[model samples]
Target: MQAQTNKTENNTNRATQINARDQRVVQTVGEAFVDDPRIVCRDVNVFYGEKHAIRDVSIDIARNQVIAMIGPSGCGKSTFLRCLNRMNDTIDGCKVTGTILLDGMDIHDKQLDVVPLRAQVGMVFQKPNPFPKSIYDNVAYGPKIHGLAPTRSDLERIVETS
Candidate 1:
């Protein structure tokens, strides 16, 4: 009985230490905001049914700057990213709150159409499956569909630049 109690105390102490360390890391990392932000997220929260997936998260993404979301699996990184473009709307019970702004415009506004929003903010999935098209066609798909390039040569230029 004494050995069992000692083991339990050791496990509790280890868990407390780990939780403290994690809190420090979360506090220190990715808390700075930029002067000119391309995207801003304020007081964001996400819920799927009864599960609170994300809570009170805020961040800024600046133009021409790359940010990485680093966390363990099932830690709401993907959920938070999907919220940027209102992708969570597809799920039946998923709910998002707070403000997500793209160039100072609220992305979750009723007037905003998700189709154009998705075209503007692209997401690359983890799975690798080639589109059934020539490399040039695949590359030009977005610009062509969005009317960004009116002519073939324009599309070629866009693809080349990209």
Candidate 2:
């Protein structure tokens, strides 16, 4: 249809306009908000010292909904994803400012412990990091430390089920 073609052209125009972007986004297009959201992020911003890596981005991730974050390289996809569980906190001089809530709990709260939070929500990196020599150790490590399994037998079962 002509309308679909026009939309693609418009999107291409927008992409071409954003050459080496520096200014913060005033707003996002499309339906960025949703009803019955499980994760709510409002005005989320990330700064690596002086560089504003992620500008004022906002969105609502609805419960049981599949969402995809598609963008070119260095557009802050990974940086913004790290903001979800406060992974940016580990990086020295990397700061995040805004409201991000996971099921109404403020992840940015200083009093919140990151260990369990990480277990609850974490990133599966593109490549496995420092995996133990054995594939079994790599699979069982998380369950072992998290006390998911009470005994070696249970750990084996868990790994097998996985």
Model 2 spans > 4 angstroms off: 1-30, 125-162
Sequence-dependent TM-score of model 1: 0.62
Give a tens-digit lDDT track for model 2, residues 71-138.
66567767777888776775778999989898899988889987777766656655445332377877
Cα error of candidate 1 at position 15, Å: 23
What are the per-residue Cα lDDT tens digits for candidate 1 across 52-152? 66765556788887667655656666777788877677667899988889999999889998788886776665654344457777788678767899988
TM per candidate:
0.62, 0.61
Clashing pairs in 1: none
How high is the CA lDDT of each candidate model?
0.65, 0.65
